[model samples]
Target: MRPFLFLGVRPEDAPADDEYDAMLRCTGLDESTLRRVRLEAAPLGVVDLDAWSGIVVGGGPFCVSDPEDDKSAVQRRVEADLSRLLDAVVPADKPFFGACYGIGTLGRHQGGVVDRAHPEPVGAVTVELTAAGRADPVLGVAPPRFGAFVGHKESLSVLPAHAVLLASSPTAPVQAFRVGRHVYATQFHPELDADGLATRVEAYRFDGYFDPTEAADVVAAARTSGVRTVPPVLRAFVERHLHPRTDSGSGRGVLRDEIGAAQG
Candidate 1:
């Protein structure tokens, strides 16, 4: 079976590694099954969609709402790479999940209005599922309402015409949405746990998501928030796409047996 690809944009080592680990924990995938690539460190190059079971993108300090002149060379390159990847992913309806920064990337690609109008502070928020969300294959696994960790400089002010709104919060109208059938993007971090969020609070404290002095308070609040239901959405994405049985030849049965043994 092909491994799932995780595209990370955090330039810092600690937070980037932590983000990858958090994703692995949430998705129930080991290092072997979940491969990570730091886009900030290098170019995305050529990505073969068929080489992976699915793709998952993590958040970073970059903001889509930043003025074109304000974007660094790295930011510009990363955006270009993501746009190129989406060109292929959207047309084929490939299995893709993006969180935080992803909403901006996918939204922009789909003609959505992404801006700072809905900037959410670094903390937990109540995410209410839309009627469409409750029926979504991946998001339906989550409860109708749950706590989710969010901290972003921008959000989807207007959803793409072709996208279906899945979840929303009081502060951010477009908490989550789906493009085509398999592509998804969420404003909240589904791969984050309380501890993981705390780490980010410290890492991005001075990055303008919140007051630098409020970093400790943000961490404290995150620790106490009931944000456990979100990770299931990430796990569901993996389960929905990672089909070991789809592999060729004897490896198919062997891989299935390995998975069964691991589960047992």
Candidate 2:
């Protein structure tokens, strides 16, 4: 089976590793099955879309909505790399999952307006599935309302043309959206659990997610939140698309039995 590609933009080792492990846990993919690529350390090379089952863009401190002058050279380079990758990934309708920073990357690429108008503080919040979301094959597994970790300096202020909105929150109306048939992005972190949030809260205390003085309180809030339903979405996504396409067509049909089994 092809490995899943996890593209991480976080430069800090501690936070990056936490995001990696969190994604692995959520996707139920062993380290061997998921490859981590850090866009901060180096620019992305040619990506053979067929080489991976799916692509996941992890959370990062960089915000696309930031003023150009405020962004460092590294951020600019990473943004360019992601844009180049998306140029390939979107048109092919590749299975891609973007969380937090991903929303900005994919949204911007798809001609959506990303801005700081809808920033969410670091913590857990109840996300409600939209009508389309409840009918989605993968996200349908989620309950009507589920807790998810959200911390972002920007959001999709305007969804891309033709994108399907899957989930939303009062604070962030475009919490989750699908660009093409298979590409998905979320403003919240489905990979994040309580412990992982706690770890991030500490590691990124001074990164402007929240006041450094409130780190402990933020961690406490995250530790006690009920977020059991969120990760299953990730697991379902991986399970649904694990198989490569056959000569016939897209391989989504192969997962019907598994999906029905889960639904049953």
Best model per lDDT? 1
TM-score of each: 0.90, 0.90
Clashing pairs in 1: none
RMSD of each: 6.1, 4.0
Clashing pairs in 2: none
Write the residue-wise lDDT of candidate 2 on 67-117 in tens digits.
Answer: 999999999999999999999999999999998999899999999999988
Q: By summed lDDT, which 10 consecutive residues of candidate 2 come out lowest?
A: 244-253
CA shift of 201, model 2, Å: 1.2
Q: Model 1, range 148-248, lDDT digits (tens) per residue?
A: 88988899999999899999999999999999878999999988777888788888777887889888888888777755436377877788787422322
* TM-score result, candidate 1: 0.90
- After superposing candidate 1, which stretches have Cα over 4 Å from the reference? 228-231, 244-264
lDDT of 1 at 129: 86
